[model samples]
Target chain A: DKKKQLQQLDNFIEGVLQEALEEFKQVE
Target chain B: MEERIFGTECEYALFHQLPPPSAQGSGKTAKWSGTSFSENLQEMSHLLVCALRGQNRPLAGEFLANGGRFYIDRGSHPEYATPECRSVADVIAHEKAGDRLVQKLVEEAGGLMAEKDIPGRLHAFKNNHDPRGNTYGSHENYLVSPRAMEKIQQIIPFLITRQIFAGAGKIPHLAPPAFSGEDWLPFAVSQRADFVEHVLSDRASDARGIINTRKREITRSGDNVRLHVILGDSNMSEYALKLKIGTTALVLRMIEDGLGDIPAFLQPVQALKVISRRPAGVHAVEGAGSGHTALEVQSIYLEKALGYFSSHAATGEEKAVLCLWETTLSGLKNLRISPSGVIEDDPGELSRKLDWVIKAWLLNRAREKKNLDWSDPHIKHLDFRYHDLDPETGLFERCASLGLVDRVIEEEAILLAMEAPPHNTRARLRGGIIGEAWGKDVEVLVENWESIRIIAKSKVDGMHPFARQRRSVNGLKANLNDPFEGCNEALLKRVRRFLDKCDEV
Candidate 1:
């Protein structure tokens, strides 16, 4: 369960960063 | 006696793909492909860890350091989590240390990136949201007992309204297509508000709640409840950060004592978003089985806190927090009643203390100066620039230099905090071990906040977060559990002996 939670958090962070990076590229 | 320890975990993105100053000087803006940027960031993370290792900095579980931990988090962004702090002042100091450390890493890596012709200078922002409606976190962690965890629902009202003073103000941009024209606000009190979608949830990423329930406690002690708050804005103003944490601590104390008189908001998630969008207006939010404005709800908490302080002995820090809270509430009330929607009598006073006020003042002035509407892209850029970690270019630093914003922590304190842990709590012990291990060249394993193993000697267990103890193989034990103890000479001596024994073996 702990591993799953950590994995979820990792994925969430990656999603946020990926979306931001993509948006940043478009705007810049 | 055990004391509550507060800490912060700040996640920030590095824009390494942008053109470096050297590249821009050549009259060309160079950009790295996203793939290359990710690869180079991974390489830089390794180099950063190596650099810290070279300095003999004790690393825990590969990434955690003495003062804090640094690693490449998800999406290749670097995250820093400060060691446990005893006070809100310590929280601010350690958080600033992170900003400095990251800036140092960027500057150091800039040379290497230049050598590799990576083309872009890395920039980090401490703010919460990006321009594309995505938000990251500057999550606050507070150590509490299991008993205090029961009072979380009671504290939600206070959290919902605190953004009036605590929010790192953001310009509204890119309203969702589902929203009608009137739903688009000109500005918001919080940068993280629009992204919040839950009233209470264990999940942090998809449906982020005001108070997170992801149950990973850094301290192994069974008694502590780690209160992870993911709702707040990433504040640049020291005063805002201090008040935000300090006032919440005081309120938690009140709730634990059963002295809380908090109202229940009807739709807390919607109320949170509304409060951030319409900070100055008195909107009806159902609370206390009736309708109340955010200011009114905040006033109730402030009054209860004041009453609590009056009945019980309040510390100097608590007193200062109460004074600031009262002053901020008054400022909000005054702004609501004012015809001009500006504090003309002492515009600079609140601007110097509150994050949202300061930012709103700056944005309003810029809007007037540039003859641009609030929806201008440049306004959003200015908002992001307010949180730039660079002292030379960050708008908040410029405001501080101009005496438009106030600071609680001293510069020297922040610099000291970068290397040294807080004097109180188990962090000092952790930091001492790291320092000694580095000095003696003894290989040790740092597991977490509570456990450290001396290589081939013994495992030092600091089970109680507040209790500092030293145990040896020969049954020579010393107790230094008191949080107020300034020096850990006895423990340091024991650690040195253990390192020597390990080396001899």
Candidate 2:
């Protein structure tokens, strides 16, 4: 249960960060 | 005697985060399961102790109970205990050097946790040290003074509202005209949206949306420093719990020890006042999105929102709270608001009702203090119902805004007096009430009213007439709601005389 949760959290963070980075790049 | 934690003082830091949901699996790589938040805290404490003492495996957990001396950079970065480069430059140079060290530690720890597939992303931050991550850390110190607590009470509200004008509404919109098709607060969508999204994910999983309301993780050794890393929802509720009331309470306790006047800069942003208690030299990193590399855009915005308050002013009563509130609200506005004037819409009227109770308490106090009558048109028009109060509470978020906290404290005094002395700490009582659903039971009574009178009498004796006046007024509470709002001037005068009598004693 813990492992599944951690992996899901990592993927979620990666996705959000990737999206934010993309937004920042576009603004520049 | 077991020893007293009442008068000892220490330095400390705090960090709050909204890590992504998917990182929970990273715990698999960790030697221990980082399932529960407390468990993770225990695990990290053990790891840091090991690193600090140069132990191969974990040492006896009793090191925490004993007065062990070892620094800790709480969160996921334990490797910063040893940075590559040694010599330091300016404060920023020192910060950066620490960051360099933490970066390596963060990766190593993350890698180790990942190997075990832990169910959370680890975000760590230390006050004096720099971090490998984006931006989210607080540094603070507590000076042992017989006067620290009193000074805190004098300055709480003024500090939270300090940075009013500059911090708010920075980002115009979430995206360009392409997405929302409207301009919003500058960087609002970038920072807050990301935070909200993170909250929605697995990292915020443990809190069930109650993350922001948790009080400080208190630690005391005479005059002690309490620290916590909270990932609260972006709202006044979060601000109240995380910074306003709790910090004010702690600082007031300090002022009683003769800390005297506070520093000028620290006065405006008092809400951001957090003291981190580590073994001294440990380094940590802070930030939400992305890993160790330094990014200018992310760093600048993060600093503007979170870092600015911690670094802005070192003194003053009103200045500290103001600056802290300004920065906090600016960051909050970035996060979207719920229809019920909170972050989530799940609990419906329950949340709305609680918010109303808080707001009404504030309004009543303000009206009394300002000499405004209850029948005034402004008071009449102002909505006191939970539904209306929810949206109305937003007015407390602006520059020079007196958030609905002081009034709450006054109401709390009434509640405390009613529940009078020789009881558990206020935190324990509030915790039981909020967390346990207990009632106005005698078990929570203020058992030490004699002690309280002793404290109050010793401190308040020949001072202001206002203190005497208040004491007299409070002495007339015959019933639970006897001194409630709208009792008329005749009642107030009577209560005032009664309170004065109490004060005389």
Candidate 3:
């Protein structure tokens, strides 16, 4: 259960990073 | 500085132990070399930078989404610096945001290391001292007028004695060269007590001091001095962090107004060490015209602060701090005078809001259960784990989840702070410019606290640290300088115009 929580946080970070990268690509 | 701005720089280690290269599963009997250590640190730093850059975000400068930033420091430790904030609440929010940011980065790095089949796990702790006698720091910065230097002298005694409540309690360690024999403490109120060797010094690492005299100004103007404090422990309790900064700010305010006569400590550094070791107020110091215990010294300052609050109109936060300070002093006094040596009135109540109390409670419980001595390694491990930043495993987070500790900010507030800056300070503008240029083909250079350069097209100069207006090099101005003012239409329009022009050919 604790590992799952950590995975969720990691997933959240990955998602934010992906979104930011996508936005940068569009702007460029 | 009109309102005291606050910021913190937190340095944290990456790995608990650096395994030798030969110990790796590669089956090569290579001799241990410095390259292994360097390589490990470099890998860690690279992973951290990648995490900070996010998936697709352009690396503009040192700042992140919220008022947080991180970089690799001299010792290969990752250091996170929160953006300047106007209130203690905002500071706490941004500081917690720093913790989240660091945790996220560390987790990502560990995953990467595992993928590469690294030999050891990378564990991070938000604490000051390592077992090898080296010290990291959680330095607190406050923007004060240059004229407040004299007032700083009056506040040193209060700073020395504030450890009774402000300390992040530590398990006993071998005494430093300066302190031994009877002075060797079984427990210390502050983790940084043994390392502080001077009353005031400019050096941070070697020859550390209570009040740092570093004369570097981050602002554009020469009117304000940044009061950099390196004495405090890296606190895990939000309530303790709030009170630590809040009470200090209140005392500084009193000093600036020339409202109280703060007694001088005969030997300030020694007094700091003594009070830190024996925070229950029994240790006597020769100062304030007579020998006074830490409790008496604190009480004197508390009385003067109460007098100032009664006469002056204090803000809601100020009022809260006054009440907490009074209640804390009373609790300490009661604990000292009682023959039982136990807090009888409301057992474990203070533990909810104070780090030292909460830690003492946990340590005492463990000691009774396991029949362990104060210097046991398990006790030290428990102390270290309390300050770990892992959400699922950190002792402080576990206690907070069970409602054993009081929280100063809500979880949602901290989450929001991870992506946005506080509304009422120059950080808002800083965060605004960085957010605006997040994905655009523009260079956002934050040279210092007072100036931001936007791709040589628009250079905004915020000469006054508290002012909201950013004067463009091309004479186009955006006035959002009021620290309390929220986003206004006129300022937004002006900023948009400047940004639009930068976007143009």
Best by lDDT: 3
Over 4 Å off, model 2: A1-28, B1-102, B110-139, B162-184, B188-505
Per-residue lDDT of B166-193 in model 3, one digit per residue for the tens? 8888864564455434424457778887
Total clashing pairs in model 3? 6
Per-residue error for B408 in candidate 3, Å, reads 1.8
lDDT of 2 by residue, A1-28 (tens): 5466435433432332233211112222
For candidate 2, the iRMS in Å is 20.9
Model 2 chain B: worst 10 consecutive residues (lDDT sum): B273-282
Task: Find the 10 residues in a row with the least total lDDT in model 3 chain B.
Answer: B28-37
Interface root-mean-square deviation of model 1 in angstroms is 13.9
Query: How do the residues B90-116 of candidate 2 rate in per-residue lDDT, one tens digit apiece?
Result: 111222223333333343454554465
Stretches off by above 4 angstroms in model 3 are A1-28, B16-39, B55-59, B176-185, B220-222, B281-290, B336-348, B456-495, B498-505
Q: How high is the CA lDDT of each candidate model?
A: 0.68, 0.27, 0.69
Which candidate would rank higher by DockQ, 2 or 3?
2
lDDT of 3 at B219: 54
i-RMSD per candidate, Å:
13.9, 20.9, 18.7
DockQ of each: 0.04, 0.04, 0.02
